[model samples]
Target: MELFFFQLLNGLGLGVIYFLLSVGLTITFGLLNFVNFAHGAFYMVGAYVTFVIVSLTGNFWLALLIAPLVIGTLAIALEQSVVKFSYVLEHKYQILVTLGVALMLQELVIMIWGPIGKNVSPPSSLAGIIEIGDFIYPKYRAFVIAFSALIAIVVWWGLEKTKFGALVRAGSENAQMVGLLGVNITRLFSITFGLGGLLAGLAGVLAAPLRGADPFMGVEALGIAFIVVVIGGMGSFLGALVGGLVVGVMQSVMSSVWPEGASLMVYAAMAAVILSRPRGLFGRA
Candidate 1:
């Protein structure tokens, strides 16, 4: 039972990482109708940025603050130069362009940060453990849970209740119609992409202490994010959240029970879900 609980906690932590990374993917898909394949690379860049900032200042908090801003700016440039070309290209071309960019970004990360990975410690204040009866949990993990929950709520509220959210919903459903109403949908798309990049960056920064920083981290994280997006139904916010948690918990639990099959299990589960309902749990057909 204790082990189950521990795995559950671990799943939730990982799920939040998925959620943060996928939210941007979800929004970009939902709004721009762009199938972004380079989202994971954004996550990796954020982690590397955090490492660089921390190495220079020895302040984790400062890295947390600056990394996202820097990443967002860089992402905007990538969009203007590379990603924007996909707007008129066929979907296949878009995928090819983005995938190529992802590969190039990975190589760039290796050149800039070197091929070696680094383990980053949580702030000293977050190093202890907390007890619940006989169960003791690392305080840093607890911190992850709290931070992720806060972000989820804020995102949910922003998307579901605000005027901006309403505009996004309307624009996504019918960009041409929204543009006819005098809304500059191209501008909206830019903002959506920028916001998505920042969210991914924030997720990367949050993950740095727990997972360490590495160029390869982005590739793996992107796969998890892709799974989450697929499971939840592309473009559906609730789907992303529910899918992330479900996949996260299942993978953690399965890894504990059968290490060899851990990787295949999650993909198998996704296959099952897709077989049962072709459009995903919340996606449109």
Candidate 2:
């Protein structure tokens, strides 16, 4: 029972990170009707940026602050320069262009950082374990959970309360109408794309301390993000949150119950969800 509880907590922590990863993808889709296959590359670059900052400054906190901004700017630039052109194209062309962009960024990372993975130590303040009777947990993991939950709340509030959020929601429903009303839909699309990149970058920075920064990690993260999106329903914020938690808890618990099949179980859960609700848990039919 103790082990189960421990795994469950770990899973919750992981779920939030997954939420951070996929929310941007979903939001971009929701607002722009565009899918960014290069999002994982943006994530990968964020991790690498963290690695560089921490290595030079020995300050994990600084990396946390700057890396996301860097990736967000880069994403905005990409959108303005190249990605925007593909928006009017079919989904297949969008996929191809973004996939090409992803490949280019991946190679750029390899060229600059080399193929070797680098470990990021948790900040000195969080570099310890918490003990409560027989239960033990990493301090950093706890921080991740608390911090990510805070972010989730802020994001939810922003989306629910802000005028920008209103525009995004309205744009998703009828972008042409929003444009007709003088919303500057192009600028909004750029901002939305940037926001998505920022979130993915944040997720990468948080995850670096846990999994280390690797060139190929983005590919893996991308796959997991897509799975979360599929399970939760594309373009649904609530779905991203619930799907992340479900996937995270299942994977974490399965690691203890069936170590070798943990990865397989993730797919199994997704399959089950799809069989029952093809539109996803919170997605609109």
Candidate 3:
């Protein structure tokens, strides 16, 4: 029973991270109809930026506040200058361009931060263990789960209840119609792109303490995020949430029982989900 509870809590923490990592990717796809393979690059940049900021200011809170903004602004610039051109291109072209961009960004990170990885310690306030009814867990991990959940709630509210979200959803179905309705889709696209970047960046910061800052971390996370997105259903916010938790918990349990096949379990789950529901658990046709 103790082991079960431990694994469940740990799984929830991992799920929250996956959720943060993939939500932005789904939003971009759902609203803008753009495939951005470079989203994970933003995640890498966010972690590196957080490391740099923390090193300079000795304040995790400051890094938390600024790193996402930096990445978000950079994403906005990229959308305006480069990605905008790919918007009208075929899906293959978009994939090629974004993959190229992702490679370039990875190389850039290596040049700036070196090939070595860096570690980040949790904030002093959160760097302790908490005990509850004979079950002990790290405070930082709990914080990660709670903080990510809070963000998830905010995102849900923003998208499901806000006017901008409605516009985005409507645009996803018929962009031409939304444009005809005088919605200024170009601006909307930019905002949505930046928002996605911001979410990825935030994920990076939250993950730095757990996974460390590595140039290849983005690539690794990108694969898992893709799986989560696929499992949850492309463009479905609820899908992302449910898929993330499911994958996270599955991986956690597998790691304990069959450490060697832990990674394979997520893929297996993805295959099963895909086979049963082509559109994903929460995805639309």
Candidate 4:
């Protein structure tokens, strides 16, 4: 029972990270009708940036603040220069071009930081364990769960309640109609992309200490993220949240009980979900 509880906490933490990146992909795809394979690259960059900031300033808070801003600003530039043009092309072109961009970004990371990975230790304040009667839990892991839950709530509120959120939703449903209604869709896309990068960047920052700041970490995340997106419903925000948690818990349990079968279990769960629901568990039909 103790093990199960711990796994649940770990799953929640992992789910949040997955949620962060998938949400952006969901919005970008659902709204702009563009395929962005490079989103994971931004996530990788965020971890590296967080590592650098933590090394220089020795301040976790500062790293959190700066990492998202830097990545988001870069995303703004990326959208303006290339992503903007890709919208006119087919999804295949968008995927191919974005994959190229992802490779370029990965290489750029290697050149700047060399061929090794970096690690950022959790803040001094968050280190160690907390005793809860019979079970002791890591404080950092708890923070991961709480932080992710807060972010999920904020994203949900923004999309469901705010005026701008309504605009984004309308555009996603029918961009031509939204644009004709005087909503600036191009600008909105740019903003959404940047915000998406911000979320990915924040994920990087959070995952840095857990997974270490590796150049290839983004590559690792991409697979799981794609699965979560598929299982949760490709364009559904709530789907991403539930899917992430489901995948995370499944991975955690499988890894514990059948380490050798861990990787296969992830795909098995995804396959099961897909087989059961072709449009996704929460996606529109």
Local distance difference test scores for all models: 0.86, 0.93, 0.91, 0.88
Clashing pairs in 1: none
> Better model by lDDT, 2 or 4?
2
Give me the overall lDDT of model 1. Answer: 0.86
Task: Tell me the tens digit of each residue's lDDT in model 2 across 1-285.
Answer: 989999999999999999999999999998898978999998898899999999999999999999999999999999999999999999999999999999999888889888999999899999999999999999999999999999999989988899999998898889999999988999999999999999999999999999999889889989999999999998889999999999999999999999999999999988998999998898877
| Decoy 2 TM-score against native | 0.98
Off by over 4 Å in 1: none
Every candidate's CA RMSD: 1.2, 0.8, 0.9, 1.0
Cα lDDT tens digits, model 1, 120-174, are: 7787888899998999889988888888889899988988899878888897798
Q: Rank the candidates by lDDT, best first.
A: 2, 3, 4, 1
Better of 1 and 2 by lDDT: 2
TM-score of each: 0.96, 0.98, 0.98, 0.98
User: TM-score of predicted model 3?
Assistant: 0.98
Model 3, 150-197: lDDT tens digits are: 999999999989998898788878888999988898999999999999
Name the better of 2 and 3 by lDDT: 2
Clashes of 4: 0
Please list all clashing residue pairs in model 2, or write none if there are none. Answer: none
Off by over 4 Å in 3: none
